[model samples]
Structures are given as C-alpha cells and as structure tokens.
Target chain A: MTKFEIRGLRADVLIGAEERQEILKGVDLTINSGETHAIMGPNGSGKSTLAYAIAGHPKYEITDGEVLLDGENVLEMSVDERARAGLFLAMQYPVEVPGVSMSNFLRSAVTAVRGEAPKLRAFSKELQQAMGGLSIDPAFAARGVNEGFSGGEKKRHEILQLELLKPKVAILDETDSGLDVDALKVVSEGINRARATGEVGVMLITHYTRILQYVRPDRVHVFAHGQVAESGGPELADVLESEGYERFVKAGASQ
Target chain B: MASPNLGITEHSHGAGEIPISKLDTHGSFDVNDFPVPNGREEEWRFTPLRRLRGLHDGRDIADGVVKVDVQAPAEVSVETVARDDARLGTSFLPTDRVSALAYQAFTEATVVTVPADTTAAEPVFVRITGVRQGDAYGHVLVHVRRHAAATVVLEYSGTAVYADNVEFVVDDGARLDVVSLQDWERDAVQVSHQYTRVGRDARFRSFVVTLGGDLVRLSPKVGYTGPGGDAELHGLYFTGAGQHHEHRSLIDHNVSNTRSRVEYKGALSGEDAHAVWIGDVIIGEGTQGTDSYEHNRNLVLTDGTRVDSVPNLEIFTGEVEGAGHASASGRLDDIHLFYLQSRGIPADEARRLVIRGFFADLINRIEVPELRERIMAEVEEKLALHE
Candidate 1:
C-alpha cells in the first residue's frame, strides 16, 4: 500500500516583505510501505524544505499541492494532527530544551500522539531496548533533550524516537551530517531496525552516497532547483556519487 | 516635639523624641533621610529606582484583615503570634527601612519552628493575608534544629498598599524545605527578604513562585556556615500585563567542602511586563573542595516583554572542585514547540506543556509530595491566567 503521496507539491519562501520566491516548485513523489527512497540534492535545493513542508511546519506555505497519508489529506491538518496520522520529520537541527528531561518529553509526546497514557513498565522496557539498539546510554533518558549533546548523539536520539514511536512515514533530513564512520554505522543500523517493522516507509534525504552503503535505497531521485529532475533505480545513486551533482545541475539547466 | 500627656514627669530621661523636622536629618536608618541614589550606587544598580519613586505619593496604608489559605499537610503545625510575644522578641522590624515607620508598626508576625532531631511526616502550610488600605508588616522566623527535617509552605496573599518583610533561619544539621507563594493584589507593593543559614552537615532547599502583584521584589540569601553543608535553590516566576517581578539570590560558602546549586526559570508576557533574575555565588577563602552551580533561564512570550538575567560567581579559592554559572533569555524554541504541536497538541497546550516540562526537573527534586503538588497547582493557576 502507498504510505505517502505528494501530488504537484509547490512551496515558496518569503524572504522579505514583498519577495515571494519558489523553493519547492510543483514537485511530485510517492513512497510505498516497506520501501526506502533516497532524495539526493545539492545545497539550496529545497531538500530540507520538502521535509519540513510535509511535516506541516507553519513557516512553510504550501502554495499548491496535496500531501496524502494513506489517502488522507494532510495539508489541511495541523502539525500535530499530521504527526498523529503517522508522519514524522527528523529535524535537521533539533532544538535544545534545557530543563525538559528526555524521558519526560518522550512520555508526553508518545502519550499525546497515542491519545492515551503509556503503561509505565512497558514503556520503560521499550525505551531501554531502543536505547540499547541505538547504543545510547540509559542515563540519557534522565538528561534534558538535545542539551549539550554531540552531533552523533542527536542523530541517535532522533532514531531513538523513531524506534519507540514506530511511525508509518519517517522523513530523515540530512541525518548523516557530522558523523564519524562508527557513529554513521550505528545510526544506519538504528534506521534499519526501525524499518524492520515492515509497515514503516522511509524517506532518506542526503548529499553523500556513503549512508546508502548501509541502508540501500530501492529508488533514487536527483533533486535540483526545488524539484526532482530525474528518478531512477539504485544505480543512479552510484552514478551521482562518481560524477557529483554538477552533471545533474547541467541536466536540470538543459531541461 | 514635647509629650502632651506626661504630667509631673521629672525631666524627660529617654532619648527625647526628635522633632519631625530633625527626623528628616538622618535619625537612624530613615528612608526619607537618605537620598534615593541613582543607578551608580552598588546596591541600587539593578533596582528599579525610577519605579520605586511612585511610593512617595500619598498612598494611604492598607486596612482590613489579610486572609491566608494553607494547603499543607495536617501534621505540620500552624500558628499566628502577636507582636509582643517573647519568642519573637525584637527580631521583628516594623520600619519600612525605606519609608514610614508607623505604617507597619501595628503588624503581627508568624513563627514556624521544626525542633531538633525531629522529622515531620508531612509538609506544613502557613499563609498570610493582608486586607484594607493601611500599612502592614510581618516577620516570619523559622528555626530548624540539628538532624531535623521538614517542608514548610509559606504563602502570602492580600491587597495592601504597603511593604512586607519575611526572615528565616535554618540551624545546623537541619533540613528545611520552604515553598513561598507571592500572589498579591494588583495595587500592592511588596519587598520580601528570606535568609537561611545552613550549618555543618545540614541541608536547606527553597522553591519560590512569583505570579502576582504589580511590583514585587524577592531577595533570598543562603549562607553555608560550616563544612559539609549544602543548599538547593529553585525558583519560577511568571509575569503578566504590567506586572514587574524581580528575584535576587545570594549563596555564600564560608566553610570548606560545602556545595550549592541554584536554578531559576521565568516566563514573561504582555506589554511592558518585566522579569529579572540576579544570582551571586561567593566562595570564600579556605572553602576548598566547594562545588557551586548557578543557572538562570527566561522565556519571553510576547513582543513587548523583557527579561534580564545575571549569573555571577566570585570564587576566592582556586582549590574548589567546580564553580560555574550560565544565563539565557530568549523566546521558546520553535522546533521543540512545533515538535510537540505536530503530535496533536494544540499550540497553546503545546506551549503550556513545554513550560510545565521545563520545571518538571526542578519540581521532581522536591522531597515532600504535598509541597510538590501545591507548587504544581500554583503553576497551573499562573498558566490559566495567561489565557
């Protein structure tokens, strides 16, 4: 079954009072359950914007397009409503909340999304298992969320949330940045574990093809100038890796 | 001035009542005799002296009984004492220290004591109410003896046109947990001071919530008198339209091996609502092995709101294991708020939950359950008023 569908997705960025320029111009994409798709793009190509717009961020205005989650209209819904409907966005730069402990934050978020209080014993057990899978210290649960954490720790924490919440569509936006080899391996492993549920669909947004080695993409698409310029099989990622985004930009300019 | 009713008094022996004109020339510590200096004065630097000048207007003393509501546990004792009580003695000062002495001359004070080596099973509640339009003064002195442990809730409410002072002390080896609630009327002006001394192996914890009053100033000072002493200070302040709340804290470590931690959080909204937090930690010489940490975090909810945070640490000895301080003032993080809202929580509810969660760590640190619940309820009321 199709997990998420984007039809004629058009988004714009308002720089100043009167400057309304297009960022994601009439893009279209689709992802099915149990499938992983990679959107490779250069800088300023609306990769993060696409993730944010799909997550219902207030700052991003969807001028024209329709986003559907299992055939349900998502643009009309609020940020949290879309989240409850199983859309999750792993932020590129997660915020640091000083006094809010990770455990308390996750508990409140999970409860709110589930519309019920999570059982204590079951929740703790699941949390412990997820933390172990991500190689995160159990003590991290007691600390504030994303406060003074390293880049690797933040990415791992994002995956920790994904593992625990088990959302249907997980949007990973540049999760591979600033990670060492070992940290990247652990993070990709965590993503694979999250996808092991079989019902979860993954959208991996990245600039480098290194992460693709661990979590192989079923389909790869080249994104330039705010829209997908080319869609092909996994071999396309390897070709882009060798030639870099210059060829794709030239192709986009010619089109 | 001559005494009118003294008949056949053989030569006045007492310090003759100075003439009202002479009283204006530095007779003791009179607020009128001393000039309200500019911000150049060290003590007056951070104080809102410009706003304080309004007290000079002919605002009469607040009259009527001030009602106090206590929500503490049953085992905790409560009592109201008269001004002449021997236990209170001359420790209670009625003078404004800045204005008229007669304004608070008729005030009654309350004293709460937890005896030595005794641990109360539940937290105690003590509320003081002020009513009418005349002056009112109150002195609260608390004594916690060695090996004693108790949580005390001191709540102040009412509408008064005068100033108030609160003083307390925690003795050696005693554990004192105090939660002070300041929810006065809009027209009221309050100046409250709380002082605590922690002795050898003793612990002192204080949680203050400021959510009311047109102008309020709370100064809390904690002194570590002996080695192995510890103190924990947590405060939360919420100010709405036209309200000004200021919190000043001083932690003094005089002995070695002492430890202290302070965390103060504030939220300000509405036009011209201002909040300030000033934290000072003084680690004296010979206070080696001392560990101290101070942090102040403020959240501004509206465009016109303002918050100023100053966290200062003066360490005299380099032998201390650790000493650090941090201060931050900004609006709520958009991503965290959006993350919460994306999960089906409305924008308002999301903001409220983030705030509630912000204080959850500090609230959970309270050992007494009853006091924790009361603090939570007070926070709820403050958030409700935000709507």
Candidate 2:
C-alpha cells in the first residue's frame, strides 16, 4: 500500500519582490492507500495551502515541512518527478491550455507517466470509456483544454484527470464547489471508483459535507487557524454539518 | 470581406477617399530609368541600401555563380531563352532599381509554361543553389494558360549576393499555387521582386517560407488582367540572431469582383533579430466589389528582437465589399506555458508545443499532406536550435 505523509508543513504565500505571508503554520497530516480523508475548513484556514504545498505549487513556499511519498522527499523532486512518483493534485482552479486538444494533452501525460506511449487504439478506447463515464461529450476530445468550459465543466475535467492519471495520492481542493447535485454525484462516484482500485489515497478538501453522502470518507478533519483542530470518523462530519464550524472557529480563536 | 458578391459590377467604381499621389508603382524596366535609392524614397526607407551588395547603386557584378534546376511534368514546357524573349516582361516591368538592375544583368531567363485547358497533377519544382559570394542577377517566369491548374515550388539555398525577378502570368479560369521556400545558408543575401497577373476568374495562392539568410527582402505584387480573380498570400518566417527578413506585398484590385487575403506569421528570437512585413492594397478607380483582409501576428520569443508591421489600404470606390487589417507582435502566451508546465510537461517541451500550435493553424491549410508534414518537421528542427 502507498503512504503520503505531510509533517510540520509550514508554508507561506510568495508575494512580489521577496515578500511572503505564512499561510499553513506547522500543519501535520497522514493519508494511506485505500482511505479517503476529507479536509473541512473555513475560508483563510490554510486548508488549500496544505494541499498546494504538498503538490509543490510555485507560489506556495514550504518554509518548514517535509512531504514524503513512500519515504521519498517530494519537496526535493521537480513537479513532473513528483507526478511520476504518484502524486496528483486536482486544482481548485485548473489553468487553461489553448491550442492543446484534450486528447493530445491526456495522451502526452499518459506517455510521460507510463514512460512509453500507449497503443493508439487502446488509449482511445480507454479515453472514450472514461469520458463516457463522466458524461462528457465525445467532441471535447478535439477541443482546446479548458477553453471556454463552464465552471462545472472545468471541475469535471479535473476529476477526469484524476481518473486517468490514477495517482497513488490525490489531493482534491474544492472539487465539489462549482458542481451541481448531479455533477457532484458523478464526480464523487468517479472518486469512489478510483478508491475501488485500492491503489489511490484521496485527500478531499471541501467546505461542505454534501459530497460525503455520495462518497463517504474514512476520516474527517476540521481545519482552522492553519491546522486541524478536531478529528473524528464520519460521525464527526454529521456533527459538523448539523452544528456548523462556529465551535471550531471559537476554539481556534481562543488559542 | 467575409464574402464577396461575385456578380456585382465592381469595375465601374473608382477608388475611395485615399489621396491621389504622383508616386505610381509601375514604370519602365530600364536600368537607367530608375533612380538610385538614397534611403529617402518610400520603397527604400525600410531597406538597408548599403547591404544590398551594390545591386541598387548601379554596381552589377557577374562573377557570382548560381545554378537553377527545373523539374516539371511531361506535358509542360521549360526553356532558357534570351532576356529579350517576347514573353519575358509580359507580366511586369521593373519598378525598383534592384529589379531594374537584375533585369538588365541577367543574360537568360528561365520560363516554365503550362498549356491551355490542361491541369498538372504533379507540382513543378525549381531549386536555386548559389555557389559564390559575389553578386548575381537572376530571372524566372512561370505562365499558366487558360483553364489550367498548377502548383509551383521554388526552393533557395547556399550562399550568394543574389538579386532576382520572378514573373507569374496566370490565364483566365486558371488556378495556381506557388510556394517559395528560402532555406538559405547563413551568409546569403537575397533581394527579389515577384510580379503576378491573374486573368478572368483565375485563382492564385502563394506561400513564402523564410528561415535562413543574413538579409532577405522579397516583394510580391498582385494585379488582375480581368474580373473575377482571387488571390491569397500566406507567409511564415523565423528570424534568428542578426538575421533580417522582410516582405512587402502590393495587391492591386484593378478589376471588379476580385478578392484578396493576406496572412503572415513570424517568430523572432536571439539578439538583433529583425523582421518586417508590409501589406498594401489599392482599389483603384472603376473597380468595384473589392474584398480584402490582411492579418500579421508575430511572436517575439526573446529579448532584443524587433519587428515592424504596416498595412496600408487605399480605396477609390466605396461601392465594394469589406476590407480589414490587423497586426500584433508579442512574446508567447505565458499562461499557456504555465498551464502546460503545471501538467508536468517540461518548460522546454511546453514552449515547443506552444510554438508548434501557434503555427499549426496555418500549416494545416496546405493541401499537400507531405509538404505540410515536411514543413512541420522543419519547424520542429528550428525549435530544437532555440532549445
């Protein structure tokens, strides 16, 4: 089984001209294969910071942290190397790539990850099946990636990547934000399918517990003030959903 | 225009509100008749006169050697006749001193002619290889007769101080495509003029690809002998350090119900890389139904590179179709690069993909698949140098 460990992860937002703001202040987390860990937090709680830090975003500088994938220091690896090492991040806001068709981009990504280009017919069939499962139009295979796509379409694209890349560890940040009830179910079902593979460890970052009804998490963590303030099982999510984060906010404030 | 009215009486109207000037673009082909350029004339302002290898200042050198090879289908005819051949100057006269001098110096002219009412399934090929550094004058003529269709490819290579004139006379109902590829050696200098005359209902398409030479300037002019003619000019170029590539085109809407479109894309990298493109369209008096649009976009891939783009349209009649022009030059899109890199693509590969995609739209328009693949491969090779 795969293991992803984030220890004492203190990171900061990189501002212009050597300026930085500490965002994730000494956060710690651990996720293992075949498990879903949902990160629920308020705005400005640095939940996304932890996800970006683990994914090695250029804007998020890990001031004091070590992210390990199977004991390999991910902080020392290049972005692509980290990906090749089985780490994936479903960005809250995916960047648009013009003139690159979806098929070409996914094929290239598959080639890079697999170290060999897949056979054309098999890859095409796989892509068509995956896209069909997501209810994506077949015509999107030829369109520019994320160009002119709606917010929900962009989110669906992210889940599609998560399914195709099949990383050992996936950090999904706010993937359910823009999705409607139907899309949320579709996306959560996709996540469940990946988990069914028993090879993916999911770190699902969300503000609401709605998606939990579709794909239940093994553990739930309440993040506030740059760290997790409370942890429990699916029952904790029930309490948080009915009661809300005011208690956690007050508790974080007192500290 | 988005579309032209084919049946409209376009030849009876005059040019629109552009001012009348005495500077006409047509004249005799006599060497002494053209004035020596002092960099003050409109035509000579952008050109570096001293770098033209004395072809402009009445200094004609014949020491340089140039070999020309022509390959054509069996039905076509090819001849190297004296410069005084009746068909030599039918399409155009020398409008500039360099063209006049080249016209005066070339002892023989190579002519490739297609018969009337026939089509060549195979493309005619011309390869011009310059062997010496001294100045040389050259002339080429291609005539496609009535109802005939032909595609001509002209490729240049090696080193020389070369000045040449190419004339195209397309007859009524004919269709022609000419692809001029300048894959020259690094030290080559080429200054040439192309004059093309289209007949009634004839169609002409031209593509100019420039990838080499220290300094290269080309002028391709288009005019119609009768109505219902169409012309398209698609150009692509890449300039490296200290290289200069320039193209100036004049499309004279001299007949009615005529259409023209011009699109050129270029990339410049390295220090002192410079490129220039000028598109001039004139809708003269008594010509109506003029449909035209021109677009030029340049990708400035590195620092210290410069580009100049100018589009001039003079219309003497308003009773015509649409006309438009656009120009843009900048570095490759940064968001595209970051997006690709975010997907784990290396920065170099991302840049190459972006460059390839930038030129893909135009390259896809080539009807010949082999030529399209060849050009795309060449573009990839050029990108490797930058890497």
Model 1 alpha-carbon drift over 4 Å, by segment: A3-31, A37-86, A91-168, A173-199, A204-255, B1-109, B161-165, B285-287, B315-320, B342-349, B356-385
Considering the two chains of model 2, state its CAPRI-style docking category: acceptable
Give lDDT tens digits, candidate 1, residues A23-68: 9988899998899999998888899999988887757788998999
lDDT accuracy of residue A55 in candidate 2: 70
- Chain A of candidate 1 gets a TM-score of 0.96
Q: On residues B1-387, what C-alpha lDDT tens digit does candidate 2 reach at each position? A: 101223333331134432223124446678888778787666676777777778788778588888899989988888988988998886787777888888889988899999998798788888899998778888999999999999988888888889999999899999999999888889888998889998999999999988889899999999898999999999999888989999998888877899999999999988999899998887767778989999999999889998999888777777679788999999888667655655666667777777877766567667767777877887777777777
Docking class of 1: acceptable
State the lDDT of candidate 1 residue by residue for B44-114, as single tens digits: 45556555434433233535456555444444445567767665532223222432332234366666777
Q: How well does candidate 1 reproduce the true complex, by DockQ?
A: 0.36
- Which tens-of-lDDT digit does each residue in A99-198 have in candidate 2? 5778888887777777788899999999999998888998988877787788888888888888888899999999999789999988888888889999
